[model samples]
Target: MGETSLRRLPLVIMLLAAGCARQAPSPAPPRVETAAAQLPEQSSAIVVPVTADLRMLERGLDANTPRVLWTVDEHRDTCVRGKRVDLGIGKVKLTPDLGCRIVGQVTRGAIRVAGAGERIDITMPVSAKIAVRDIGGVLGETATARAIVHATGRLGVTGDWQPRATLDIAYDWREPPGIDIAGQRITFTSRADEKLKRVVRRLERDLPKEVAKLDLRRQLGDVWQRAFTVIELSKRNPPAWMRVTPRALGFGGYRIEGRQLRLTLAAEALTQTFVGRRPADPTPTPLPPPSRVAGQPGLRFFIPVLADYAQLEPVVLRTLRKLAAGGITLTGIGPVDVDFGKVTVYATTGNRLAVGVTARVVPRDRDFPATSGEAWLTAQPYNDEGSQLVQARDVKLAADTDSTAVDLIVSLLDATQVQRAVALALRHDFAPDYRKVLGKAQHAIGARQEGDFFLSTDVTRVTTGQLQVTGAGLFLPVRAEGSARIDYRPR
Candidate 1:
């Protein structure tokens, strides 16, 4: 055979073996690689076709569904997805703005992602049914509960045996009035995992706003210094509030384990005393005439605060040191007493104002150990900026860890701290948001300024014997959302 004829024969044989035509399988559609772009201006739109390997997609959704009685085309199918769906088959084009309308027998297998464009209206036979279809990231106003959703922003899990992923947002079943819905609905996006990555970027952009929130969180850590506080210190205290458990996973947020947080102070910690008038020598003064009893002497002087109220003992104490310096020899000491005559509340307009007092004092008896014959007073209020610090006078005192001459400076200091904390928590916790720190995020790219996309600002967690707060020392855990511009290029 001629050389040209020989080469032709070989080419024909190879094409037959390689199966490039006729019974040959068509090449798999090129993988879709969407380019980043501005969301939409006027009818900004883009198109994506239906995928062939869809049953796998359906299984992914089934795994996310809370419950299901789903059904796909019945062909003696050993469908482990087990849900049953007696529906027709077909494909619908997707767009960007105007959501594409779906019409046809819903397959647990069908996956639809409509960006923005004019809707694709599908027309199915009269017996039409669309099972559960979940369009994640496209929130519908009012309904996805806030159940302390424990989330691991970077990747972690803790729940029931079924690996509950950060992507279990499968579509709960629903249908339009005239349309039909199978027993249950479970449809997931093809790139549900990718959504998690987007959240990381979002968090990075939102870190700043959390500054106020973080301050409050830290203060709570300081105040509640309960089992979560300087754990090592708690160990030193012995018999402390023993609370240890797996902290629920959460990113860009602080979880208050449960409500009705209770706080209390110890009575044994207070021990101090004040002084009043009495005789120095234990010898009973020559009995004053009974007339004297009925006179000024008859006037029973009770200084309960000067000493133990229960033990009306007249003991010499040092609350009044200048009296000693004044050379006024007191042949007697006290039952130096005090009482709060009234309790009134002051606040501004709306009256949602909150004011509280946390005081630790020295008990009367042991309070003034040295020059223990003086009166102790207290009234410290921490107010907002440009606001007056409310002060209360003559608050009865007894020596305790957080008490002092100038209003139990330690306790006042603590109260001052707590006041700041409470204010921040109430003010910022309710109204502040850090997501905006990522201002003007390319809304054009369909990204939102939400906690979902929050990122941390260089922080690390050093476990405190298993149960530990996210950040330690002076830093707060912030959530920065969206992208940032770093000028340096990596080596």
Candidate 2:
């Protein structure tokens, strides 16, 4: 009987060894699968159009110009040979001619300036009064004439941003100076027209001198320096900034409206966005020569909205836990419960995101062993253009364990429910941040003055780019588009 028992024990030992060999392998230890380092930051352009107001030039002309332009005094021979001159009182007979003296002055009125096409039209009013004496040696009378001096100023800017103009000056008498007496008229239009030529020459020479004093270079330099600084998009919450480093100046040309001359200077700059604290301003470079600008000029800048991975972890954990509340049914394994542990998210190469989840599977069947391991998943984050809602797409579950049971479980976890859970977990609504940033930008981008130069901007449109992940967090580049203008207001 002892020998038979020994034989049975040997068979039992063999069976036990077989059972040990059949047991599932131990689950791989939870690994911290780190994503690739964040990619290098890219930069965008900020092209702001600078509108220069030239109303001051008109005022300078008014201040520097003289009230009275020139005076006219002339005496000529009046002929009535073999003719009878009929005066209002009686007829006067002249043997040969009479000496006549005409003396008057052309007085200037208010200076008027208006924009016509690409040129500025300047109008100067003048009045001429002449006294005609010894008309036939019998009668003398006084006559008056009014005229307007017309000047067309072709405005231009030098390479150094100096205001320059070439004027074509001319004048016409509104009412010709003439004396009508004794049914005869004595006119002085030819003589007055000839005298006005001198006034035209004087104006053509002096007006440009005034325009040169506009000192647009100084004002433009101030604008260029101010543009080199940083602009705050948000003060707190997410603290974002845009550093503008001017690259070049572009001359789009000029236009005139009313008395204002607008010079379109496109300030081309390389703008980079920062998410955390304020970035240092870019060092100012010397204002470069004007470059030729193609396309329209406007303000373009990106406002980065970041969501820290640390902040997103808890949200993802909570979502995963909620989704896993009811036992997750594994195919051929019945209801398999899971206790969600920690969640780690980071950026990966190819603009993708890597998510690692530490989870312990609780088995319902005693025969099945409890398994604990991490499941590393990858996905692409994106958003629609101009939308603030960020969502995950192209989700893929990766196996990071050696145990066949755990791999099967992870395979089942890649089911629709788990994938949906992860997708929902990645759902981040940036609507509030978008509205706040836009509001703050619109308010902050308004009129900003430095000394006598007033810079104003009007935001016309807002756009958004693709979602980008970095070591810091998820960043959505929201761009603000608008037109900017700079005015020179001498205080």
Candidate 3:
């Protein structure tokens, strides 16, 4: 071969070698981070008021008691001593000399029921009239009497949430009726008293039947089911929800006010908060037998301040892209240029966050070739006390394939610039969200009606909790403590 041709062959070999180096295959993408975690459950209360209208008992009394309670009819003769005549028998037998006929009737007027502490008082007015027929031209007379039937009723709730009343009934005479003839006074109180005994028995038997009309069990059941709900704290930005699951039932006792009896029912529940899409409401369970509950029942729940991993991706990508725009310098390698591909953020084990970055890196150094692959980094995010700024510490770096090319890129990731950028992306201000959440929640808990029950709530205080990293996102638990009450107002 000629010398000039051999020289040209060397240049061609050099050009072919450069093309082969640039055509090397790119490394595979890194695997995403995985973690299993759940937010802590909190305790809360759902209070229900079961009310019974006592006017029903009044109507029942009016319907059950007859207007004409009883009637009395009797005829008797009393012998009168004739003037002392000559030859009159010394001890003449008491013979009928005066004829008397008495007829009487007892009738009820109106019934009224009123509340007295935990018990109720039922009162009814009664009137009686007696006519003594004129006999032997003896002046005829009519006697009238007034009386009142009084009953003391005690209210109670059964284990299964049934309302019942027990009545202690009796009657008192305001005016006694009687007749007077020849200094002989005839009283009808004994006969009236006997009739009252029967009336009292009937009232005692009928009170509970009237109380059943209150429908207390149905009211309580509606409250129990309504308590199992998911209350939305915020609609967007960071959609937050609080789930309530009733666990047990408690009896806070009963009170009589005006003409109604109110039974306080407290439901002990487990509350949990979530961020993102709304959570499903808990399935309602049957009303359980009430147990004694201590202290005043109040509402307690958590409102989570969350940062979804998907939301963090864009923020992190923007930071990385801006930093990579000017190119970054490594410790061992002098100056290297980087172009970001995709950024992924998610929770990892030990309450840490995992960030995966895909990039195509070019090195200015002669020994290192241009490389393209994904780099994985893990960090523990934390927020200082009374501060909203979140920063990361103990950042670790890894890759799918370990080599000098990947190590150079990892060194660039170790720079404070990248670390600070990630930390800045994690910086979440909870003040605005906190205030908005509280305001919305307060509005949500306002007095509202569900079925036949009226619900009301008052939030007194809120306490902040520690930060948690779950599979879904970064969650900060904010516990709200308050009081809640539900009244039975049937429509």
Candidate 4:
């Protein structure tokens, strides 16, 4: 071998070494990290349905009916111009005096809600009696009589009643009918003698004072007012956990089908639920404008849940540190350092969530050294019934890594194992404490007592929807549906 050839062999070896070093890609450039977006303050809504049947009102009317409706007492004076009477066997000039009194009562039949133009129609069966006493006149004539009189046999009355009803508003009855006696009949009792009967019929045209005693307005008002009072709903022995405030009441007219009159009642109000304690008395404030009913009649309410990423930082960091302390073994690199850094969360399309994390990977062998990397994970959130919280599920790594260092780390590490570990850690700390917050909210919304009324909420169903990224952490909307009833407990 020549000396020049040996020198050329050394240069060739140097060139080969340079080529080998160039095969590995260059480390990624440092990123100028920006501050993460902050959570916003916002609100969500839920719509509830309300329904009222007119039949329930009828019960109140029946209970409030008075046994005696009316009574009457009347007096009159008469001057006999010329009259001659024979008492026993003597003849005498006589001037007679007269007085009368009558009493009557209204026996009401079934009061029904009439259709469309008519608010309520009722048939009243009336019975009355008459009494007459004639004081002594110039001829010394004194007599007393007791007899039964037939007045209005069956009186049919139709009342046009309008009620005020709206969402989150006050309620009242409008355009109620006045008590009418236009169709009333005036009748006199028949006596055994024709002359005496004729004398009794002379006062038939006079209106019975008992008709004035019937107070239909006051009676009807009591029925409606009692029905529209506060509604109470609760389980036996548990007292009441919730209350509903009915703000307004309105009638949807009525329809007569066969013998039944079906009436519709519209009641608008807000519902509240209590968790730990119950309120002694809670007055109902005017309701806000009600949301339109979508499908059926049922109570509805909205609940907001916030999920903050900051709350999860400590849990995630702890899990990552635990994994790092154990030193994960790689396929070819043996045991390696898996150190995790900061994490940021963001909202994405389709009501989903994304988390970005910074991490470092160091191979056990000093020759490989360590590299910083960034990773992104996408997740879908849902309501976890068992935990009573909204939890992150189906966590997957997003594929848009611009960092070359992160790309190198991906190639050297077991991607599946890392993803699995991260997902498990997220599952542990990715949700808020729903049980605590919701429990407090429920307790705060407890039962209230209005004037002569008790309002309580009866929660039947609770549902949860997907997560929404808003300025206010992770926003989750919850819906609760139930019914509101007003019960009358007189003070």
Candidate 5:
């Protein structure tokens, strides 16, 4: 309490020597979650203790046998002594002989015991903003530490505390990077002793329980183990669920002019989050056009087409997300073309279905006779629709014996082919409703060409089992029925 008593306290002196003693290794590091990475709600905790050696202090000072130095040695005789701070533990009695020097103004509030050769000084308020790197054992040599502790400055205790009454204890020891004592306080309460015993007893029982719970946590803590396995595998290799196949059922020369490419996308095996209600897209409405581009040369045509750009899902099915979501987007393109006297365009996609179509084309000069009948254009002799197509009459030459008598037969044939094929094209554009579980209905289109000396004959037959191409992209329905009108100069 008074300056005289502080100086009277027995000092525990220590000196460290590199050749003899060494510092103990610090605790191991643990896993950490950065701000960028997501962390779970719970974390693990730890437990440890605090201890000190009165025996080692006595050996360092050789209290029983005083060392004989050079007779004139003034250093050890004039010991670096000062009024040291005493650490009292409850009713623990601090003997008045622990003489320690009060070192450089308790900067960090921790105590230090330093030894240089035979010179020993019990440094009080041992902590500092910068750490004292070199600290050997009490033997004053670099050797292993006889003891280690997990004490904190915030607990009003950081050094090796000697318990005159209460045993030095470390409870609920969590790895603290900084002095984060959530709520630790020391009160000279009358019942504090009773409270400490109760808390210690309860914690002794509850800590083992908490520790037991964490052991279970180490088991059930990671749910991503199985999920991430599939994800990582998919990153290195393709997933088994996704399969994409592309195909086209072309209508050959029956297309209005040059063949048009119509793309159809079919996806399957998708997560429920991305799937939504089926939207029935508007079919392309037909608009009439000129029989031929006046003063236009060569059998070339312009074809304008469109496909479903309206995405049904929230996120787009890119290569990455598709693999992540474990879904497939089957994409394919097909084409159908018919020759007019000039460039022509037929078949295009709207919001969902490729609906409208038109083509500008110029037929071959009428040196050859033109085929008659819708069946003739769709027939094997010129029906390129079949795999083994027989191009018997891909084109014919112009026979302008006169404007009226000259061959308009080729034009008639081209017109018939364009009509039937286009009807089929529109039918193909519609997509099946994805909402229902069942597949789409069937469809088909047939055409027959009839001819008379008076005018050319073009007949059409449309048939369909059922169709679901309501919201899908443009296509030539393999099975569908519909008819289209094509005239020879407005016959």
Candidate 6:
């Protein structure tokens, strides 16, 4: 009987060993999974156009005309040819007399601008009056005379002023002459009379010298200099950004609309994001080819933002610590200490964002101890109207732990609540920073003055596109759209 009992004990011992081996827990499932987020190859671009109206040119010309152009001293020399009759004899003689003086004033007429083969053709009508004293030879030295002349003309301005700052300006006259001497009209056939021709020649030579005194080249140079000046776009902490390039400049021709001339100055504004203190003036580059689009001008550009996970990890950890500090109690467990291991952000099947979270949970109660688990959360990102930020919405748990204790803890934790809290915190903390940077950028893209043209930009809308994973961090493509208004009012 003792031998049989020993045999039974061996079998019982074998059964007990088998049961213990079966009951022992398998190695705890991996705490967390690492993931890599993918990004797109190409990003969008920003386009900005600058346009100028010709009517502004007309206004500038009208406003800046000088009232008194030329003045002659009271005692100036006068030369004139006269026919003297002695005993019914007619003879022509040239006489020079003293105490002669003249004064001329500019009476401007309609001004027009035309586009002609890379040059702007400006036509201005000249209506001027000259007061001449001592016009009736030495015998009639006290006789006074007045003459009014009218003609159409153009400014002899030649050079590549649009691309380069070089400008050569002179005066050139055009069309048939209309002259009135003492209210007596003179008609010229085939050729002007000797007196009229002499007066016209004097006008052709003298007017340009007076016009040159205006020094339009220098005025225009100052305008172009301002145009080429660097315009700031964003004002950040250490470095600022700016728009540095003017790609194209040309006339889109002109048209007469009602009482005004509508001229178009087409230009393309190119921008590069620069981050630093404002630098010295850049050398002027050759103007780009003319822009194809006509009429109203606007600008477009693309801004790429790197949302690195490494930088974001601290934010997440801080949020989790705050939640832990507030004391989160699971249904079956007392208050627990929650510590996150590694967090990974990646793109899922549908280009959505998936955040993989690894966590260690230790119950306050001495009986329950500690456990490891993972949570894969799926979320859709969108631009929030309330906060104006790239925010996560529709947060859901994709995968989590299978351990009974951990599973119960996760269930009570409510992935939706956790994800919502994270999304709110991220948006609240990060959105204002993005807005501050963008506001500085918008202010930096200020108004510019070029010649008679005043160009200003208004950023109408700002929006964000999809989020992608990159080696540097999470990449977000932002777009800004705005209109550029160019007014011609010389200052």
Instruction: Point to the candidate with the largest TM-score.
Output: 2
The TM-score that candidate 5 achieves is 0.16
Candidate 6: tens digits of C-alpha lDDT, residues 1-491? 57855555643454334334433222222222222222222211222322334455545554554433333334444333233445546554543333334444434455554443334445455443444545443322122222334333434333433321122223333433333433433322222234344444544454445434334355444544455555555443324344445545554544444434334455555554443456566577654444454434555554444454556666666776677677667654557777766665545544446565667677676445465555566666555433335566777666544432234224423544467666664442345545765676677665756665566777777776655444444445456667666554546
Error of 3 at 176 (Å): 2.1
Q: What are the Cα lDDT values of the candidates? A: 0.21, 0.70, 0.72, 0.42, 0.20, 0.48
Instruction: Encode model 2's per-residue lDDT on 1-491: one tens digit a residue.
Output: 57755555653454335334544432332333332122223233334434445556667777777776667667777622345688889988765555677777778887777775588788888898888777667657788889999988787777887777788888877898887755667787887778788777877776777776656678767777887888887886567777778777876667777556666676666767676767787999877877865545667776667777787789889988887796587654457778889888877666667777877776575444555656677777888887889999888765443442234346445767787788888888888777777887778777888767778887788777777776667777777777777776667
lDDT of 3 at 455: 80
Give the residue spans of candidate 2 off by over 4 A: 1-57, 70-104, 132-140, 181-195, 236-238, 277-280, 294-296, 324-327, 331-333, 336-388, 393-399, 404-416, 442-446, 458-463, 479-481
Best by lDDT: 3
Residue-by-residue lDDT tens digits, candidate 3, 215-260: 6678668777887898887786457778889888887777788877
lDDT of 1 by residue, 1-491 (tens): 76855655643344334322224211221221211111111110111111112222233333442222222322211111223344456433342222212322322222221111211111111112432222232322111111111112211112221111122222212322132222322332222224323433433323222212223233222222221211110111011111111111111211111221111111000111111212122111221111100111000111010001111111111211222233221111112222212111122112122122222222233222212112222222222332212222222222343311222222322333323332332221101111221121122222212221211111111111111011110111221122211111112
The true-structure Cα RMSD of candidate 3 reads: 8.3
Worst 10 residues of 2 by lDDT: 35-44
Model 6 reaches what TM-score against the true structure? 0.49
Summed over model 6, clashes come to: 13
lDDT of 4 at 246: 50
lDDT by residue (tens digit), candidate 4, 1-491: 67855654653354334334444433332222221222222111212111223343344443444333333344434322235599988968774333333333222344232223223332222233333333222222222222222222111122423222111111111211111112322233221223223322421222111111122234324433443332223231112243444554443343444334333334544445332234344453433222232234555654445555565566666766787787676654457777777766656655556666677777675434465666566666665542345566776655544432224345332355665665665553223444444454455444554454444545566666545554335655455555444433335
Lowest-sum lDDT 10-residue window in model 4? 164-173
What total of clashing residue pairs does each candidate reach? 70, 0, 2, 20, 78, 13
TM-scores, one per candidate? 0.15, 0.74, 0.65, 0.45, 0.16, 0.49
lDDT of 4: 0.42
- The lDDT, on a scale of 0 to 1, for candidate 6 is 0.48
Instruction: Report how far off residue 74 is in candidate 5 (Å).
Output: 41
All candidates: CA RMSD (Å)? 44.2, 7.0, 8.3, 14.4, 43.3, 11.2
Q: What is the lDDT of residue 195 in candidate 1?
A: 34
Off by over 4 Å in 1: 1-188, 191-193, 196-258, 261-271, 276-491
